[model samples]
Target: MNIGIIGAGTLGMTLGYRLSQAGHRVTVLETGAQIGGLATWFDYGDFTWDKYYHVILRQDEQLLSLIDDLGISPRMQWKETKTGFLWRGKLVSMSNNWEFLRFPVLSFPDKARLALGILYIQRVNDAGPLERVTAAKWLTRVFGRRVFERIWEPLLLSKYGVLYDRVPAVIMWATIRRYYKTRSKGDGKETLGYLGGGLKTLFEALERGIIEAGGSVETGAAVTEILAGEAPGVAVRVGDEIRWFDRVISTAPSKVLDRLAPETKLGAVSASSAPNYLGVVCLALVLKRPLSPFYVTNLIERGMPFTGVIEVSALTGTDEMEGNHLVMLPRYDEPDSAWFERPESEVATEFLHALRRVIPDIESNVERFFVHRAKHVQALWIKEPPKEQGPRHTADGRIWSVNAEMAGRDTLNNNAIVQVANAAAQAIGAMGAPAKAPTAAASRGR
Candidate 1:
């Protein structure tokens, strides 16, 4: 079967590799010069680093399995990571039960409520009617207003801007539960995993697998339109050439895909109002000394223009070629936000201000800085939800839709990838002599 994938991010690359290995002709269309999408890396003359802050949870099995499958198992490394909350002009360690108990911001009763709320979310499998339920109202009701105001609201406002109230309570619960489950032992310490060099190694390996299996990956080839006149096939427009495929799996954002597929009324798959994504300018510093021993710090003070989840270089256990430290400051806001398009000097001033507050530093110790911005980081998908509508996957005859945002229930999990891969295979495989027997859906590929 001829399959065309719209994007080449981790999800796209992984799917392409698996499907190509199943003896189908696979082709990937990437608009960017490089692959990996949000998981992409940039070279800084001396070292290569990710444009935005990225770290894997200890439970990221798909990434782990992919590393080993590519024969790069030795490159995978893990470390006991620490996180802190910056509140009232001090860094309060919040990575453990003991520290959480001692944190001074919340009242004793409020702290207890927060604790109970965390447990409730983890234990409760079904979050009933969470769509109509807003996170702010739900949290404040369960954990009191102080917790919501001090910790939760700021984080939501930082991530979602004015749409903070639109986030469902279940999202908040799911995020917390996911975080709790991925910690180190019983201590609340976060465990982080990183590939030796960067995720580019993994992306390259997946690319190789796809090509070796007779799949073609076309870079800088953006599909302007997808014609679905033929049953079980799509006509993709490339410059002047039109390529046809038996099936199309779009990993591109639904907003982008909606424009490409004109034959169907894509039913709110392309949202009327875009959900806000923070534009990030990552300043990767090769410092003479490490900034902080901790891996992440959530900015709690108001006036600090950025709330970055910092990644200390030495912690990821990568080789320090120059014996220098690596640190990244991620600033999230709308693309049109003043900071996103700020002049270099103004942006540098903000970076220095945030750094000085956290790290006791000499201005002379700075080594390097780089800025990167992703226009559409993640789908805002800001609909009121018991059921949060991402992209709609209408069964348009032979045109089967498999996108990252539409992979139901299991998100960012290896199971989700495997599930979509199997579903697409089955959907396409059932289409007569045009296809071959694909691998059966399993937790792990044989």
Candidate 2:
């Protein structure tokens, strides 16, 4: 089948790799200058690393298997890392069970409820029921109101604003299940994996594999229209000309598809059911000194401006950053938040000023700083089994949705996305897609 994929993010790239390996002619289209999507590489002067902070857990089997397939598994490395919790003008390490017990902020009962709830949620094999339940209700029931207010509530507020209560419990369930990897070894330490050269290594290898396997990848080639052609053939508009394909799978947001895809063919989903996205505004810094001892310092203090602090260098090692440190202060702003439009300088200053309260020496230790922003990064699910997910294929059965909540309820990660891509390929193949093109046709138009 001649397949056209929209949004060459990890989901798109992985889908392309899988489909090509399955003997389909694939062309992955990306609007950005490069692939990786959220996991794209950023230029940090002397070196480059992931555009946002990302990590690989020991349980990330899908991602690891893909790395092996790309012949780059040798570059993968694992290390022990610590997690930090900051509150009341102090930073505390919460990497181990003993530290969690000794933590002063929460009462013994609160801690017990929190720990016990996590243990229970981690073992739950089925989280489908959680889709209809609000995270607030589930958390309140399992961990008690006190724990919810003391710990999880602030995080929800910081990320989702007033819509926090509307978030599905499945998100929470997925998070706990994924997090169990850190302690599954029975050790107090949290071990994380990373490719030696960061995400760039993985993506580069993926692109190579896709091309070598008779697939093509395009960057800065945005698809503005996806109209259904003769049955089982789709027409994708890149510039002035329209290219036809046997099948088209889009990883773009539902709203985008609502505007671009031929709604009359498959019909458009209601706007109300599409999840609103939480865009992130981050102050990325190349620091002369590390910000905190932990890789991630969850901020719980009242009135804090940002969501959390991540010292990426802590996980990858400072030597990778040319002997400097890498820090990111990310704030997941609501859809209507002004941070998306505010001046980058102003946002950076505000984040740094608020951060200085905790790390008074922050500005002094910073060698370089960059403000980065990406809208539509994190999906905010307000309803269970979103209306858009009811049908993976359109009425014509030519267009398919790949990453659209069809990926199922899993914590947002490369590994989960890899598995989603694998599932998509298997489904497409099982449906008996047409024969692959002897050679990929060239994309026309500028």
Candidate 3:
């Protein structure tokens, strides 16, 4: 079989590698100059690291298994990390039970209610009922009005903006379950894993594996169109060339697909209504000194530009980064939000100004700063997300759409992306053989 995979990100590349290993001829097309998509990295003058923030939890079995299969498991490292919360103009620890007990954000009774709420959520094995309810309603009912207003609402607003009110409770339930399962049993601390050289190493290894398995990867190859082939396959237009393949797997966003392959009516994949997406504007900084002792600090206070401050150096270490602290300040908003059009320097200035509230002396420890923007970082899962409408096979069955957002059982992450890609490959394999050669009329139409 001859296969064409659009968007050579981790999902696309992984699919290409798997199909190639199955003895199929594979070719991957990538629009960007680099491959990893959201997992891609940038090269600073002194070093190179991920453009966006990504951490692996011990519970990420799908991602871990993929790493082991790529023969890069030895390069993985784990670190015990702490989390902090900024509330009422004060930073406080909340990583352990003792610190949580001492947290001044809520009263004693409120704290007890919060613990019970978490336990109740963890006890529910099925998420179906939770999906029918909104996070606001669920939290308010379980944690009471005070906890919901003080903690849950602010966090939801930071991530989902105005759409937070309609977000499904199952999303929050899945998040709590994921982190709860990743905690260390000995001390109840969270342990996060990272690749020694970052995700760049893992992506490069995947690319090598694809090539070794007889697949071709082309970057900066923007796909312009997808039309029905002369025979029973699909035809893709890359630049001025039109290539035919027995099957086409698209890992690009649904909007991108609707534009490229309108003939396929890919819009039906969303059942006419599309899922809302949140974009991220991240400011990565290399500091002369560390910002905080904790790896993650959730900002609960209002009037802050960024949601949270991630001091990745707490886990990645400064030695590999030439003794410079690496911090990421991520601002999530809609794609049409004015923040996306704001200049990078202006964004950096605004973020730095707000960051001072958490670190009073941060300005003095400056080094280098870079800003990165992703148009679609996360998909907002609605209470009734178009269930009957999602990534699926076209009427012809030769074209398929697969992406991280289509992950059924997990949230959008590298692990979920890999799982979706694997499932798509398996389905394609079961289809048997390549399409017959194009007919004379179809060839003339091209």
Q: Model 2: per-residue lDDT, tens digit, 63-132?
A: 8999998889999889888999888889988888889889887999888888788888877888778888
Q: In candidate 3, which residue ranges exceed 4 Å CA deviation?
A: 388-391, 437-446
List, residue by residue over 334-432, the lDDT tens digit for candidate 1: 667677677866776777776676565735677776666666654444454214433344464434455655553232344355455545555555553
Per-residue alpha-carbon lDDT of candidate 3 for residues 1-446, written as tens digits (9 for 90 to 100): 77889988879988887788789878899999999888988886688888887899887887898899899999999998889888877778888878778889999999999988988888999888987889899989989999999999999888778788988888888777777876765666788999988999898988898888777889999989988744486888988887777788888878888888877776555646667788998889889988888898888888899888899899899876878889999988889989999999999999999888767888888788998998887876663566643457776677888776677436667877877778878888887765474543553335
Alpha carbon deviation, residue 88, candidate 3 (Å)? 2.5
Mark the 10 consecutive residues where model 1 has the least summed lDDT: 437-446
lDDT of each: 0.67, 0.80, 0.82
Summed over model 3, clashes come to 0
Q: Quote each prediction's TM-score.
A: 0.86, 0.92, 0.95
Task: Let me know the TM-score candidate 3 reaches against the reference structure.
Answer: 0.95
Query: How far does residue 95 in candidate 1 sit from its true spot (Å)?
Result: 2.6
Runs of candidate 1 with Cα error greater than 4 angstroms are 229-233, 267-281, 312-314, 318-322, 360-362, 384-400, 407-426, 430-446
